[model samples]
Structure formats: structure tokens, C-alpha cells
Target: MSALLVRHEANRLGRDIAVGDIHGHFTRLRAALDRARFDPAVDRLFSVGDLVDRGPESEQVLDWLALPWFHAVRGNHEDIAIRYAKGNPVDQTSYIANGGAWFVTQPLARRPVYAEAFARLPLAREIETPAGPVGIVHADSPVRDWSRLVWSLRLWRAARDRAMWSRDRLQGENADGVAGLRALVVGHTPVEDPVVLGNVHHIDTGGWMQDGRFTLLDLATLQAIPPMG
Candidate 1:
């Protein structure tokens, strides 16, 4: 498998935290980061994607992503937004119905900018840290042809095609429930609670839903910050 070895210099004494879907709730996101003692100047922040849509502050979230310390993978929402920006035929009705109205309400100038940003997000990223390797993506794969699956442009095209599914369906069979060298980290289907099934972990806690909470996972210790409130 071809993977980029993403290396970052360790801070004097800082933790590398990977967070799940933000979904535009900047307030709660900020609070969670603060509670986790995340120092943007030193500690690194990686997001599993879905940084926009379904909540207030979508613009603010995009602005925050432009920061150097923050890295992210492209989520399905981002895929739809890019298609919309390019004037491609998208499920506008479904998108708007599902909090996509926020993007439409954005200033025209900002729309293109955020769309470009979303388009630039990586499909998958390999974080090579002192501890181990972590692979970040919006979802996992269950196709037993794992090697072929990762190399297939078709799989990525399908994911970017804006197909909608329930949380369970989205989880598929590889829903962070297996163990391997490449630990999978993802945030697509929001969960009532973060799940740790093997070497993979699902951190999307649905901060946009009622009684929802944002979560950050420390890569080095493999610990979930805030202890699941």
C-alpha cells in the first residue's frame, strides 16, 4: 500500500489529538479543545472530517481549518459542497434538507473559498508519530479485497458521489471493530458514544444532535479526552 509518512516534530511536552466530526458547532468544539488543553501553538490537531454543515458556525469552522496545526480528511458533506460549487447536479433537495441550507446562506464569495478548501482536503492521511501509525478517513472499508479496495479510484468516487445511508450502514463491516497495523480513525456516522472496537476507534459523537458532545482522541496514549461526557 502506498502511504505518505506524515511526520511532525514533537512539542516539548504536548499531546497530539485527533478529533471527530465538528459539524459546524464551533462553540462546543472550542470548549472541548480547551477542556482537553489543546494548545494550537504546540499541540497538533487532526480532524476526521465533516467540519461543516448541520449546525451554526460553519464559516467559523472553515476559518479555523486554515490554521497550520490543523489537518483533516474530506467528509461526505464536503464532497457534496464541492460538487454544488462546481455547478454539478447534486441532491440539492436532500442536502438543503439536511442542514446544507447553511452553505447556501453563506456569502457568495465565502462559498467558493470554503468549497475550494473542502476540495483540497485529503481523502486519507497517514500520521506517523513517535508512538505508532494512525490512518484517518471519513469511513472504513469492509471489502475483503483490502489492498485492491484502497487502490481503487472507484471506491473513492462512490464515497464522493454523495450516497446517503444510516449510521449503521455507513459503519459497514470495518467500523473500527478490527485490529491491524494501520489503526483506523474516522468520523462520519455520529454515535451516541465513542466506540473502540480493536485497533480502530470511532470518535464522532454527534455534537450537532441533542445532548451531543465533541470528542478528541490522544494518539500517543490512545485515550479519549473528556472521558465521554
Candidate 2:
């Protein structure tokens, strides 16, 4: 399948922390990690994607991706970079307008490298936690049942697209939560504070914006670590 689904075993040694969309703010991410006292020797960090774009450190995405403790899903911004690098149809104006100017300025030889790395990221991840299975997607969950997510995403293009781009759950008044997963965390749409709609938790606190603070959430407890003072 073009789109991929990955499962991670429970972190028996330490914490499994989930962070919101990075949007190229590696410096802010590092500072937040320090505040959380994250230890790569034991703690693992998971990203909701958008690792590049918007911020000045867009070029440092690869370095962060190479870290063994970092795991991420594919964000829509990454999709734009991938399509452009692969010679697929993309709107250059839209891409540049949405904090992708840095990517367009990258060397021709290096452009494909970003695409290659991002392309490797799975569209959906099911991480086993002490509490239960936590699903991570860039946007919204395509299926109401998490158990069928893997096959649905693999077999249906619509399901894969919704996984990375849909926002229906947030915009609508649906009070129902996805079944099977203890919690589903997403990061594409930014909010002033983390919002929980049923079992889905929206944690994109606009870390890439001038006034926003990155949120570090404890996956097992479903609680956000307070921002550094």
C-alpha cells in the first residue's frame, strides 16, 4: 500500500510522550523537552507531524528525524514537499504562502532527501500504552473504530486522505468518540488550548506561532505537562 500503518509496543522502560505539530520549530521543541526533563535513554517522544515549515529551522528537520527517540506521522505540509520532490502536481503559490518558501529555496539535490524521509513516515500509528492503545494521526481519524484503521487506511485511498486531512470531527458537534482506542491524538488544526472531543484529543497548541507554546502530553495518563514558566 502507498500509505502505511505502524504499531509501537508499550514503553516498558519509561514514558511515551506525545507532542503536537512541530512546524520546523526545533529550538522550541528542544526547550520543551528540557522542561519535561525528557531522557532519550528511556523516554520516547512522538510527534503528530508537520515537522517542517513555518519556522526558521525548517532545514533542521532531517537532523531531528534521525534521532532514534523521535517518531512522527506524515503531516499535510510534508505531503506538499513530497509531491513537489516527486514531480507530482502541486500548487507552488499555495505551498509558498503556507510557510513552505524555505522548502522551495532548498537545493535541487537536497529537495528529494526531505521527501524521502517524510515519505517514510506512516500515515497512522497505533502505540500501545499502559492504559491502552493510543492512535496518532496528523488530522482526524478516518474510521470510528480503531481496530479497523490499519486495513481501512491500507485498502482505501479515501480513508488515507481523511487520516491526514479531515477536520470534520472538530468542526462538527459529534460527541461520539472513536471506539477501541483509549485516545486518539491529532495536531493539524491549532487551538489556543488542547481540546478533547470525546476520545480524540486535539493538541496542536500552535507551537510554531509567535505566541503559542508547545505541549508535551503524557501518553499513558492523557495529561499535558505544564508549559515551562
Best by lDDT: 2
After superposing candidate 2 on the true structure, give the runs of residues whose Cα lies further than 4 Å from its correct spot: 1-3, 227-229
Number of the top TM-score candidate: 2
> Lowest summed-lDDT stretch of 10 residues in model 2?
1-10
Error of 1 at 114 (Å): 1.3
User: Using Cα atoms with residue i matched to residue i, what is each candidate's TM-score against the true structure?
Assistant: 0.81, 0.96
- Tens digits of per-residue lDDT for model 2 on 22-135? 988999999999988899999999999999888899999999889999999998899889999988988889888899999999889999999999999999888999888999
Steric collisions counted per model: 0, 0
Candidate 2 residue-pair clash tally: 0
* Candidate 1: regions farther than 4 A off: 1-13, 142-150, 153-156, 159-180, 227-229
